[model samples]
Target chain A: MALARWPYDDLFRLFSGQAGPAPRETAGVFPPVNLYDDGSVFLVRTEIPGMDKTSIEVTTAGDQLTIRGERVVAPAEPGASYHRRECDGGQFRRTVTLPQPVDAEAIEATYKNGVLEVRLPRVPERKPRKIAVA
Target chain B: MGTQVQKTEAGTQNPEIQVREKQAVTREPGTWEGPYFEPRVDIYETADALTLMAEVPGAEAEDLQTDLKDNLLTVSAKVARVDPRWKPLYEEYSVGHYLRQFRLGEQIDQAKISANLKDGVLTLTLPKAAAAKPRRIKVTGG
Candidate 1:
């Protein structure tokens, strides 16, 4: 007999009820995500918990961006224990595909408050202009 | 916020117990505690650049420090939990240390990294390097 293995993505899919619209039974997904455009770069932000500053990894490929990290909820020192479990603890992989071609050479990502943010720069374009004298 | 939460190492336990323990474990409203912790953050994107705002309700300027190293952004802050100035019979918020990490992309200019804190909110701005700016290139053909 083999035990089942589950990651945070699976848990998120389950929480989102994407597998089947069963009205998600478990608590909501951890680290909600937000995407925004900064004219120059597209920004993606995610919420992650109990993670060290060193555990996070950010990389990009063409139009795709990925953020991988682990969340260790365990603390070295202890004061009080858990009364409720709203926060999720474990590893998280968040990848975002850009809508258009982006400058892989000029991407940026930042993390704070257990949240990871990635910024992808847009590729420059060329245009034709028409000039006329008044 | 001044309640104590006990850890249950047992394999099988009630879910309600886990939930209550997390909340009652501390005596502060805006503090970080326990193994499973999450912080709500707001990301603001503009044409020029992007700004990340975090709610560190009671954290002071000096207590917070941010660094962007090797494309990884790290934020660490500590709050003094005990102060004898006022006597408190009850507390709903507990102050503790906070540390968070982020993996970054290349768009962030390694040189101009700046951070500012105001009204319990920490804002970090990542500027685009000059080389990355979009510019028109003239084309000539024979």
Candidate 2:
């Protein structure tokens, strides 16, 4: 049995027969992310609620992708006091190294329901190619 | 006197942000088939009403459901699953539904309760009942 750091990771590993937990720490980082690869493209997703689209900035340089944004929470109404406060507002920046070089010009990003999805298409030469036998 | 709430000033050195992982809550058997997460919530009290804000990313507005029975309020959202073709390479967070329940301690006007979902945050305003609202009694000169 593999020692899984997270229950979801365990479930995925069980199905895929993969070993070892993710390399990065999941809890300490701001705006945790999920990265996926599908041969031709890679998808990066993050959840950042209550942020304006203009406030978010995404950029890619070589094999590194960076995401920066700020979340501004409105001050409490006058004469109002907090009973429970868990959500926070602040600035955050995260950078992840891609497994392979990508076509940065072709990348596309979309944000919906507070989820940001970035699609990075792999460079043509890096993609797997099929060969014919004579 | 009004309570003072500390605000994170802009342009100052920002504090390190920590990720808030979703928590699983115990439920009776034969409930929803898939696992659900407890969303983080903020509750504030004013003279007229109590406001609740919850973070439920990837949840559609139509998929959110809220129930108010007596003093117990339950909020739940069904998040759409990702496409199966994309193989997982690295994952730091899991996608799942959101569910949370709150037991109200004050009398709330059930009919006046209203909810709105924006940018994956659910805002609920629970107005206080007439008897629950604070009132000032005039002291006449003796």
Candidate 3:
């Protein structure tokens, strides 16, 4: 994905000068994704821990695949106080552009152990055809 | 602070999700194949126990290991490697194992510590020792 300048660049810059290792320099858009191609299918994998499967939504349109979800963190027990809070809770939507056309109708998604894997089968015509020389 | 800004921004229609890059942990002098990330965690304290919740996606229950030596508590997990048949085309995040350690501040009943893993999150409940629990004292009139 071409690095589209994040809209919050300026907002983050304002506090960048304050101190220590400005939030993971390599950090990219939320729900960081990894795409893998294995001849017949392209797999998209992302980690969204502690999220309910019902809250996640996956959609594919043309060459664009979108993943939208809400992660609701359980509230601390009454009278309990936090010593440290790092995990974030909220809504996240990430749309990834596919490198090649895919069979959207055959797309399959599975959520296991907080990880979401979306399998997009390559269109039949798009797959490399083996040719025999005359 | 930073968290406040994130909260407000998340309320917007197209909120930008903050993706904190995984922090790599240093290993001792030995043969270690893959990378290990320090999972982000939330630690909370109640009157009876101290709870720690950690995010370790892709980790299975059987692969998780937790150990307490002295006052140091360590949590680690082994994640299965990606299938060899698939070739990565575009990558934004790296997958590997998880490891993290923390030192205890309050006295804990180590024998009663319990851990549970569900949907890629590990929750550990560390019960506070009886002596460590605060007691209400009544004062008699002089």
What DockQ do you compute for every candidate structure?
Answer: 0.01, 0.47, 0.36
lDDT for every model? 0.51, 0.82, 0.81
Q: In model 1, what is the error at residue A53, expressed in angstroms?
A: 2.1
- Per-residue accuracy of model 1 over A10-123 as CA lDDT, tens digit each: 336644666442121212222334444545566665444335767888877767666666554433123322222333345555555555688887877766544455667789
Candidate 2 chain A: worst-modelled 10 consecutive residues by lDDT = A1-10
Superposed by TM-score, candidate 3 places the C-alpha of residue B80 at a distance from the truth, in angstroms, of 0.8
Chain A alone, TM-score per model: 0.63, 0.75, 0.74
True lDDT of residue B44, candidate 1: 45
lDDT of 1 at B109: 84
Model 1 per-residue lDDT at A73: 42
lDDT of 3 at B19: 81
Which residue pairs come into collision in candidate 3?
Answer: none
The parts of candidate 1 lying over 4 Å away from their true place are A1-30, A75-81, A128-134, B1-142
Please, what are the lDDT tens digits per residue for candidate 1 over residues B9-103?
46623211121111221333334443212233455444445556555544567888787877788776665443343222112123345566667
The per-residue C-alpha lDDT of model 2 at residue B5 equals 58
lDDT of 3 by residue, A89-133 (tens): 877778877777899899999999889999999998756789999
The sequence of per-residue lDDT tens digits that candidate 3 reaches over residues B38-119 is 9999999999999999999999999888888887989998888779788665566788889989998988998999999999
Residue B19, model 2, lDDT: 68
